[model samples]
Target: MSKANLSDNKMSATCSLSEELMALLPQTKESFKLDFSEKVEKSVVILLHQARELFYEGKMNECLKTSETIRDYSWEKLNTGTWRDVDKEWRRVYSYGCLLKVLCMCFKTDDIGEAIRVCDMGLLMGASILEDILVKVVNVLQKHLQHGKRPETKIEELSKKKTKSDHTLAPAVKLGTAVPILQCPSLEFFRKNYLVPQKPVILEGIANHWPCMKKWSVDYIQEIAGCRTVPVEVGSKYTDEEWSQRLMTVNEFISKYIMNKNDIGYLAQHQLFDQIPELKQDICIPDYCCLGSGEEDDITINAWFGPAGTISPLHQDPQQNFLAQVLGRKYIQLYSPEESESLYPHETQLLHNTSQVDVENPNLIKFPKFTEASYQSCILNPGQILFIPVKYWHYVRALDISFSVSFWWS
Candidate 1:
């Protein structure tokens, strides 16, 4: 047979196999829930379909290009607190794209080792939906290596280099002992000592004059916002798959999460002051916010109310924040933007603003850099305001049935 005819037959057979595998997968009526803008999702799906078509046509190079496009887009969308059961369908499609790219690398470029490394990355990203296909790819690559058909890839060379580099750095370094507390510093003093240096400081007596400081108890909050439906975070922390958003009345939130500690639910980041004008009258914005970009109208005031043990993961905000403790105590930790590399920020786009390492109980073996990242910690008391500069990493854990308000300014 002619070489052209032989190649055509092989492509036809491969297309048939691809179709059969896809057919075997179960179908669901539920629509895939991607945790991104609709524009991003649409673009990714288009590229994914293009990659599949190229694969069936036996255009390995074109298939690889299209597959890589999908992979890159997926990585960018992989944000923290966005991964959940609803994303499983999108993840499955992403895994298929990764597998196609691995096949092209192995068969077309003869890079068996690189193909294996790519497979490992896909698996790490919770792409087990294509486990059967990945296993087959790995086995084939292993056979190629055993036969000495391909050269060792760059991944192996990099691994050897990393081993030498790892030994050069110290295993761990301790963070700061404590955060400083200032007793109502003037606007100029605060701007110079804390805001200019981008440091964190707990300011006492800032909210003592606010009526909310004395009036915002569980009973008072329930009485005022009891009937209003508000968004609540229903989990101990935002990182879990079971973590989800719930909308309920303020009274229900107080009864379920605060009154009884059966499960941790939080009325976090809600604009209570805006929603209930009565609440806004109780507190006043500090004069320090005028030191910012001078956009007072653009400032956002948000409320955070939750039971003890509720946690806000290590994350950075785009605006300068003034976190005021109103009714309870909270333990907070802050890391400067300079230590971002040491904090091991997530590579995926979804969690680009958050750290992958758990600040409380860090996995040193997996994230050794976290140990070298120094931080300042404090226990925020009622009537204290914490100044957090833009992009400063902060993690918060309520020590009691805490109620805090945060003002975000430019």
Candidate 2:
């Protein structure tokens, strides 16, 4: 069968499970023909058709269920015949990690404390020991996809190759599972990098690539930081009870402000205390939480900076973002919109688009599927940038008294 046919078959197999389960996977808009290269086009075809059918049918429950089960078929077959059981279980443990994650999101939105528990269960499962990252190819592709700007370079040559190339830096370990294929990065180094495409860049040679410095340094930052403006969006409506309760500490920071999201559109302006002056650099951050260009807009840029314990709930940005760190440390667990089956975005209209679990302390019974999610973890230091694609579910922690910048672009 052709590539599109195969992935579609996977989705058809998914539809056979149940209508509710099938409604979970979101459409990518790109065709089974357009997505997945020749290598996985067949698989994409199978996955795509069932996804569309279930979504159309509103079989969210079944869509999530099938997505959970199908994660295994995508694992790379091993050479050791006897190890097959281990392989299957491995996929089950993690694929379910993604599954429970979705279920948890369903509950978190529909029900809450329960979703928090589910998120924790998934984390403990170690199902996602190996994870795939949101790889950003060259800017030309990003520019092309975002605004239909034609590539000055040859698009055909870039399209011809799969993702394994020099610029698209993948993890050090070999990933033996079926990875979703996106166009890899081009050879150009200066004008673009994944960080740049995702947001603006700030190079801090002093803090770039420090392995574990981000673990708990907010107070340290409050004392020694320099004057750099950060975005905040708390509205006039929220009283001190809600605002102070939300933005207070690292832990409270994540819950009320980061993960605890509502449409109040509250904001806070931040100033980092310690930016080494001899370095002669201070960043003028953008308020991307309310992002738009020239005049008309679709998104915004909201921000938080503090010690360990800060958090942001799993929500998708209508537009893409570039998140970079200036000091201390942080961790981000991410899942794309296409992987909604694993993340379990809400079903209830109240929190329909919001993830269900209280990522700070997830409750599991209500959101059993959160236990199955496999997410990409990013550690941002003085200068590293993480390009978070639009609509991906992300859970974040301060790790330390951290100073960071987020750029939201159309």
Off by over 4 Å in 1: 1-176
Q: Which candidate is the best by lDDT?
A: 1
Q: Give the C-alpha lDDT of model 1.
A: 0.71
TM of each candidate vs. truth: 0.58, 0.35
How big is the positional error of residue 137 in model 1, measured in Å on the Cα after superposition?
A: 63
For model 2, how does the per-residue alpha-carbon lDDT over 231-268 read when each residue is reduced to its tens digit? 34343222123543232222233223333323232223
lDDT per model vs. reference:
0.71, 0.41
Where does the lowest 10-residue lDDT sum fall in candidate 2? 132-141
TM-score of 1: 0.58
Q: Which 10 successive residues of model 1 have the least lDDT summed?
A: 164-173
Best by TM-score, which number?
1
Encode model 1's per-residue lDDT on 55-126: one tens digit a residue: 656788998988888777666555435556336545555666678787666546544556656764564453
